[model samples]
Target chain A: MRSKIVLVLLLVLYGCSFFLRGEDPKLDLGDNVMEGVFFQGGYGMQWVHDTAAEFERAHPEITAYVWGNPRAWDQTRPRFLSGNPPDVFWGIHNINFWVNLHDGLVANLDSLMEAPAYGQEGVKFRDTFFDGTLEEGQFEGHQYFLPITYAISGIWYNKGMFDEHGWTEPETWDEFLALCETIKQTGGGVAPLTHQGKYPSYFGMIWRGLVYKLGGEQLMCDMDSLVPGAWSRPEILEACRLSRQLYERDYVLPGTSSFSHTEAQMIWIQGKAAMIPCGTWLASEMKNALPEDFDMRLMSVPGFRDGKGGIGAMEASAGPAFWIPVEAANPLAGMEYLRILLSRKMAANFLSTVGSVQPIKGSTEGVNVPPATQSALDRIAAAGGETFAFQFSGWYLELENEYRNALGALLNDDITPERFAARMEAMAERLRQDPDTIRFSRSPRGDGVAAL
Target chain B: MSLQNNGRVALLFVLPAFLFYLTFLIVPYALAFGVSFVKWRGVTLNMEYTGLGNFAKMIGDPFFWKSLYNTVFFTVLTGIIVPCMALYFAVAVTRKLVAGARFFRITFFFPNLISQVAIAVLWWFALNPEFGILSNFLRLFGFTDLPSWLGEPGWARAAIVAVKVWAAVGFYMVLYVSAIEGIPEDYYDACKIDGAGEWQSFRHVTLPLLSEMMKVTGVFLLLNGFGTFDVVRIMTDGGPDRATETLATYIYENAFELGKFGYATTIAMTLFLITFSLAMLSLWIQRRDSVEY
Candidate 1:
C-alpha cells in the first residue's frame, strides 16, 4: 500500500508541472480581481504596490494584485511567447520586451491615451504629459508604451572643482579641447573627464551630441535610414578623430577604461575626475556615495568649431515606460490601474517616494528635490529650446554594439578615424541586410526625436 | 497469480520515473531539434521553416569555429589536469602519511560548496587591477605593468581555466577519495609485506582500483567543460573581443541577447551530438581496458 501511494504521488507531481490553469474558472473578470506586474525600481518596489493598494481603495470593488520584479521583462518572456503575458510592464531596462509589439504580443495603448486622465478634468491622457514622451514609445506609428518616468542624460561635473581652479566652461569644440588640455596640465592624478568603461553603451551621450554638432539633423536622418555611405561621412570621421583626442592627450583618468560604471561613478564622486558623461538620475543614484556638499551640475555637449548644428541640442530619453500585453486576462482592470498610475496624486507619490521626475509637465516645480536635480531642470530650461536628440544605438542594438567596440578601439588608439568609420559602415551594412532586424525612424522635432 | 502479479507490480513501480524522464529530458531534447529548422525569434508562435538554412550558415561562421576551439582547448586542459591533481590530493589524504588528513579533506572540498557566481565574484575581486592581491603581490616585485588577468585575451582564457580547475578539483577529489577508501586493505598489506615503497604500492595496488572512478570523472569534466557558462559570463563576458567565447556562451548570446533562437538551437544541437559521441568513445575505451575484479 505504501509503495503504491508513493508511485501515485510521483505521477501526480510530474503531471502537475506541465499544468496550466488556463482561463480563470467561470471565464469572468466581473470579480474585479486582476494582477499587475511591474519592474521594481532600485530605490524601492513598495511604490508600485502602494499605488495598487490605493487604486483598490478608490474603486472599492476592484482588488488589484501587483507583482514588482527587477527582472519582470525577462521573467515574463515565456508567458509572452505562450500568449498570456502579464497585464503591465512598469519599469524599463535597456532591453525592452515590448519591442516584440511587432509580433502582435502587446496591445496598442492608443485608446487609453485618448481617454481623459483619471482626475485631471478637461484634459486628455496624452495632453497631460510632456511633449515627445509618448512619441518615443510609438511603434509602427501607433502608441505602444505609456511614458512615465523621464530621465535626461548629459555630462555630469563638480562646479566647485571648476570654480576653485578658475576654469571656464567650454561652449564649442575648440574650447572643450582646450579645457581638457588645461585639466590634464592641472592634474594631481585627476583626469579632465571620465566615463563608464565596461559598458561602452554610455558612449551614446557624448557621441550623439558630437554627431549633431558636426553633421546636423540631416546626417542623423541618413544614418537612421541606414544609407549605404552614411556612416563614412566626413563629419563622422571628424567626430571619431576629435573624440579620440582625449585618449591621445591623456585627459582620461588612468584605469578609467578598466572600471565598471559604478566604480567610475565612485571615482567621479570622490573628485578624482572633473567630468563624467551620465544620466540625470546620477545624483540620486550616487546619493549615499556622494559627499554631503558634492555640488553636482550638468552641461550640454559643447558644439563643434564652426559647426552647422548642435549649438542648441540636448541628449535625453523617456524611460521606465509602461505597457500592457494583448493577451492579458484582465486588461480592462490593468488599464484602469495605469490610469490611476498616471493620476496627479500617484505622480506626486512617485516623486516623493522615488526621488526622480515623472513625464508630466510642471510635475517637479513644487516638489522638494535634491539640489542636483534642480540644477538639471534649470539647465534644460536654459538650453533655449534645444532639440532633444537620440542616436542609432537607441533604435538599433547591433549598431550600438558596433559603435561601442569601435570607441573602445579608439580609446586605446588601436584604430584611426577612417578605419573606425569604415568598420562601423560594414557593421551597419550587414544589419541592414538582416531580415530579423526592426527599424524605427525619427527626426528632431521642436524639442525631441518625434516619430516620422 | 503470485508470479505474474509480482512482475506486473514491479513494472508499475518503475513507470513514474520513466514518465518523468520522458517528459523533462527526452521531450525537450527532441523539441530543441525541431526548433533548429526554423527562423523563430523565440517570443512568438510564428516560426518560419528555414529547413537546414541555420545549419548552412554555421559552416561559414568564423565566430562559431573560434568558440568551438576555445571549448575544446579548455576541455583538454581540465581533462588532463583536474583528475591527476585530484588523484594526487586524494592519495595524500588517504595514505595516512600526513598529519591533519581530516583537515585537508575538509579544506579542499570547501570551494565546491560555494556557488559558482559567488566564486567568480570572489575571483574578480582577487584579480582586481588596482587593489587585487595578485596585482599587489606583482607590484611588490617592481612589476608596474601587470597585465589584467581578465583584460588581456590570453590571460583571460587562462584565468578562467585556472579558476574552473581550482573550483572543480575539490569535487573530483572527493570521488577519488571514495574509490581509494573502498579499496580492500589486503592489497596494501601484501605490498607492504613485500618491501614495497610508497610509489610502488600506489602504482600496483591503488591506481588499478580507482580506474573506474577516474573514467567517470573524466567524462563528467569533459561534458561540463563544453557546457560551461556561469564563470565565463561573470569573469570575462567572452571579451577582450570574443577571445574566450565558448559554445555555451555563443548560444546564449545568440538566443537571449541577440534574439536569434533558431540559429542558437542549431549550434546547441551540434554541441550536444559532439559531446555525446565523445562520451560514448570514452566509455568504449574504458570497457576495453577494464580488468574484472
Candidate 2:
C-alpha cells in the first residue's frame, strides 16, 4: 500500500510542472498555431499576405497565417476584450493605446527592443530607427508601440505644375500666401490649395509643424503640459490666423470641403490645384489614379518669418505601429515575428511594394523608392534627419476632439483666432479638472530627440 | 368555463411574449438606466457609481444642448413635410389618378427597401458637388458657384434633413395608403352622390378616417428624426463644426469613440425621457381629442 501511494504522488507532482502558474506559454512553433491580424488601411491586403508567406517559409516549423481588413480594430475588439487577442496586431488608429496600457492589457515591449535585430549581429532593434522616432509610441517612460513606417506630413504639390508656372515653393508664411494669391489669380480653373476637409484631423500635419515653427519647442511643451492659455500663445494664434487666411481669401479649392481624402487627393494629382497639404503616403495612396508624369513632390511647411524654431522643422513620426497584447497566446513569438516583420529586407520590400518609407534606417538605400517618397526623404535629410512630434491633444482623444472642433470652427470662419484659443483653453481647463480622465505625461520638447 | 378561468388561460397565452419582451427590451433598458448613474468605461468590470454626476454634466454641457437643438430641428422639419408629402402621394395612388397606380405604389415605396446605410451612401454620391445630379443641373443652369452641401454649417444640416425626409416619405406613405384602403367604399360613394369635389372628399371623408395612423406616424417620424444616426453618420458625421450633430450621434461619439460609457448612458437616458414623454403625451392628446367619422 505505501509503494502504490508513493507512485501516484510522484506522477501527480510531475503533471503539475507542465501546468504551473508564472510559466511562459509554450511557444507555438508547430505548423498550426501562429497567426497575425493587421489593420490593412491605405496599404493593400496582398502585401501582408505575402509577408506572412515569407515568414512561414523562414520558419518551417511554424505555419503563420495573416489576414487584414480596413475595420480590423473594430472586428477584433471582442477578441481583445475576451482575453483572446490576435498574436500580433496593428491598432493605434482606432484603439486607445494609453488606456489599454493603463489597464495592463498591452504587453510592455521595452525588453523586446533590447533584443538585437534578428539575423543582424550586434545591431540592437532600438538603434534601427532615427532618434525620437519611437518617442510617439512611448507611454509612462516605457515603449509599448513598435513603429513600422515613418510617415512625414507636409505640403504635397505637382513639381511639373510648379515648374510650368514658374512658381517656387515658398520658404516663408508671407511668400506662401503670396504664391496662393498668384495661383488663384492665374491658375485659370484651379484653386491655390485643396484640403481633406471632410476629415478635420488631417489638419494635424500643417498645424503641428507650423506650431513648432512659430512657438519652437517651448510652445509645444506648453501645449503638451496643458498650461493655461497654451493654445492662445502668440505663435499658436498666428498659425491659426495664417491658416484661416487661406480660407478667408477664397483660395481653397471650391467644393473641397465635400471631398474625402481620396477625392481631394485626386484633385491635387490631376493638377486641378496648386498644392494639397498631406502626408508622404499621398503618392502611394493615389498611385492608381495619378498621371504618370504628375511629378508629385512634398515640401515642409514654410517657416514663419518671426518663428523661434528651426526653419527646417518637419512633422514626422513613427506610425502604423504594431503591438502585442499581454493576453496574446504567444507574446514572445509575436515580438519575434515583429522583428522579422520590420527587418531591413522586409522594409525594403515595403518601400518598393507600397512606396512607404519604413522607420528602419538604411532600408531604402538600394530600393527604388517612388519619387514622391524620395522627395520627402530628401526634405527630412535637409532637416538634419530628425523626427519630432508634439503630444498635446495627440495623446488624449477628448482634447484632440475639442481641438479639431475648434480648429474646424476657425477654418470655417465661425470664430476668430482669439476665440478659438479661448475655446481650447476653456476646454482644456475643464478636462484638467476631471480627475478620472486618462492623461499622458510628456516633455516640452517631446520625450526624446529624434534618432539619428 | 368560469370567467376567472378564462382570464388565467389568457394570461397563460401571454406568458411567452411577456418573457421575450422582458428579456430583450426591459432588461437592456434597465441596464442602461442603471449605468447612467455610474462612471464605467463599459469594457470591463471597473465601474463606479456617480449618482447624478453624469446628468449634472449634461446640464452644463454645451454640446448636449447643441445636439438636442439639432435633433429637434430635424424632427420638426420631417414632422411637418413628410406627412404632407406622403399624404399627397397616398391619396393620388389610392384614388387611381395616375395611369399605373400599382407601379406608382411600388416606385414610391422603393427607397424603404434599401438599408439606411445604403440610402445614406446613395444620397452621398447623388449630392456630390462635381458629379451629383443636383450639381450637374445647377451648373447646367449657370449656377457656377456650387455650394458645398455637406460641408457648410447650415447646408450640412439642411442636407441631413432633406435626405431623411426623402428616404422616410415612402414608409409613411405606405402606412397612409393601407389606412386609406381600409376606409369603407360606402363613404366615398356617399360623397360622390352628394356632388362633393375631390378636395372636399379628401378633407371630410378620407382625412377623418385616417387620423389614427396619421397620429402614430407623426409621432413615429418625430421620434425617428430625433433618434437619427445612420444617415447622418454616413453623410455629414455632424460636421462643419457640428452644425448637424444629433443627440444619437453625440451619444455614440461619447460611448464608442471617446470611451465615456457612463456619460453616454446619461445622455441616452435624457433622450429616452424626452422621446417617451413626447410619445405618451401625444398619444394621450390623440385619445382624448381625436375626431371620428
Candidate 3:
C-alpha cells in the first residue's frame, strides 16, 4: 500500500536524521592550560579576571582563560555532564556540593591546602586562611571546597545616626531591648530594627546568634545534626520568642515583611529605621544607593547576660565557595590559580574593590575598606575563638525552606513561637526520616564552631 | 488524478512536519515518562529504578497537594471569569453600546501585546506596599495601613488571579469580537422584527449563534489557565508561605532547585494528564450540540 511505503520512508528518514547529526566537536586544550568559569554576580568579574591575569603572569608557560556571566552555570552544567568542566569555577550556587562530592565530581583540596602559601614565607596554604573559615569546606578530614570570601552577619546602623542620638551599641539582650524602646520613643517615627523580610534567611543569622548565646555552639551542632527533639529545646524556643518580641512589640519597621531585600535595606539606609540586620556584603550590594553621609557600621547581635557563648560571640562564615572539578584537564594549575588568588595583594584588592573580606588572614591589614567591612573584620577579630556558623540551613534545603516559611509567618504575626518551632521540628523530623534526603551530620569542633 | 495518488501526495507533504513533531514532542515526552519511573538526581547517569516510589511520595507530600489545589483553583477561576468578562466586553464593543468602541477594543487588546513576564513585573511595581501607585493612591484616601498585596497569603492568591484575568481578558475579547462579527446580521434583523428586545435577541439569536466560538474560547482559556507560570513566578514566586504555588512553579522547584528530577517529571506528567482530560471533557460537552450558524 502507498501508506506503508510512506511509513517506511518516514522511518528511514528518521534514521537518516540521526546519522546526519555530527558528533560534538572536541575543544583543543593545550598543555598547562587552565580554564576558569565564574559567576558574575554583585561582586562582578573584574577581580576574577585580574586574578587570572596574575596567575598567568606568575607562570608564563601556562595560559589561563576566564569567561563568565550572571548565568554562567547555565553554560557550565552541560560541560560538567560531558566530563569537560572548567579547571576552576566560583560563585556557582546551582551545583550541590554534597551531591558533587558524593559522585566524585569535586576534587579534594588537601594537597593544595598542605602546599606552601603563594607568597607568605614558610606558611602552609591552609594556615593563611582565617580560623573557622576553611572548616566549612572540609569533609571527612579533607577539604573539598575553597571559600573565597568571608562574611559576618550582624546588625548594620548609620554611625552618624547613632553618634547624633548618643546611642551606643548594645552588648546584652536587655540593653538591646532598652535601646529599641529608646529609639522608638525619641527617634521621631523611626522603627528600631528592620530586616530583609522578603528573604527570611537574613533573620536566621540573628536567631542563630541568639542560639549560640543561649546554649553555646554545641546546641547549634545538635540541631544541625538533627539530634532527636533538638528543635524542641528551650534555647531555640527562647530565641524564637525573643525574635518574635520585635514584631509583637512593634519595634520592627512597619510593612517590612512586604519589602524585598534591597527595598528593606534602602528603608534602613534612608534613615527611616535606626538599624537593619544584614551581612557584610550589604555595603557592596547597596553601594550606589548609599548617601555620601551614610556611615554604615556593623555590630554582633546582642546576647543574653547569662549566655554560654558570651556577648561577643558572632556568626561568621566563608561564602561564595570556589572549587576545581575532579576531572579537570589541569587540576594542578587550578590549584595554583587558587593559591595566587588568596595571596595578600589579591586579597587586599578584593577587599578594596568588592567592599567585602576575603578568608585570607592579614588581607585587611593596611587596606582601606568601607567602614562597614572594617566593622565586620573587627567583630570577627573580637569574637576570636567564639565565631560560629550554623550548617543545617545549607545542608538541608527543605529544612531551610520550612524555617524560612515559619520565620516569615512569625514575623508577619501569623504564628506564635511555639507554632514556628513545631513547624520546624516537623520538617526536621521528615528530613531525618527520609532516606533519600542527603543529611550530613555535624560535630562541634573543640573551638566554638560546628564542623560539617 | 486518481484518489489514491492524491492521498499519496498528501502523505508526502505531511512527512516533514510529522517527523518534527515525533522528534521534538513525542521523543522528549516519552523520555520524560521513562525518567518518572526512576530515582535520579538530574546531574548524572546514576539512576535507580524506584517503580511507584515517586508516585507514593507525591501522594503524601503536602506541598504537592497544596500546589495541585492552587493549580485547580487558578484554572477554574480563570477559565470561568475570563470568558464571561471577555464576552461581555466584546458584545459591548461590537454592538456599539459603549462610546469610543474602537478605542476600547484597542485598549482591551493592548495587554495581549505585552509579554507575560513584563506585565507581571509592571503589576508587581504597581502593587508594591510602599511607594507603589496603588498604596500611594490608597494613602490619599486616609488608608494609613494598607494590606501587603503580594506579601499576604490570601491577598497574594487573589492578586495573582486578578492579574491573570486582567492580562488575559483582552486576548479573549479579541477572539470573541471576531466570533461576534462572523455571526450573520440577518438573525439580529429577524429578532428585531419578531418584537424581541436587545436582551431577548442576545439571549435567543446571538448566544446560540456564538456557541461554537464559545467552545473554542473556553478551551483556549482553560489551556492558558492551566499553563499559568510566568506571571505567578515573577510576582509571588510561590511565596508568602507557598500560598500561590502553582504546579508549574513547584515542578521547577523540585527539578531544578531541589534536584528531584524524577519527582518533578511525575508532577509534570500529572499536570499534562489533567489538562488533557479537562480539554477532552470540554470538547465532549460541546460536541453534542454545536451551533453552526
Tens digit per residue, CA lDDT, model 2, A384-417? 7544666664466777888877787787778898
- What are the per-residue Cα lDDT tens digits for candidate 3 across A317-346? 884378989889888998899999888889
What are the runs in model 1 whose C-alpha is more than 4 Å off? A1-30, A91-99, A160-168, A181-187, A343-345, A409-423, A443-451, B1-10, B60-62, B91-101, B178-212, B291-293
Better of 1 and 3 by lDDT: 3
Chain A of candidate 2: what's the TM-score? 0.89
Error of 2 at A283 (Å): 2.2
Tens-digit lDDT string for candidate 1 (A1-452): 99999999999988887785466532364656767877665556666887788888878887777777777766767877888776776645435343466667778788888888877788887887877676777766688777667777778888889888988778777788898888888856678998876566565578777887788777777787688898899988888877787777878776555556777788888888899998777866676798877788778788865775657466666743678878988787778888888777777777776777777765676678666666666666776545555546656766776687667656656578888888889878877887767765655453335344
Model number with the top lDDT:
3
- Residue-wise C-alpha lDDT for candidate 1, range B217-280, written one tens digit per residue: 9899989899888888887777655667899998987887667789999999999999999999
Candidate 1 residue A328 C-alpha distance from true site, Å: 2.1
DockQ winner, 1 or 3: 3
lDDT of each: 0.78, 0.81, 0.84
By the DockQ metric, which is better: model 2 or model 3? Answer: 3
Please state the error at residue B204 of candidate 2 in Å: 2.2
Candidate DockQ scores, in order: 0.32, 0.37, 0.42
**Deviation from native of the Cα of residue B166 in model 2, angstroms:** 0.7
In model 3, which regions exceed 4 Å deviation?
Answer: A1-32, B1-5
Alpha-carbon RMSD, candidate 3: 4.4
Q: Give the docking tier of candidate 1.
A: acceptable
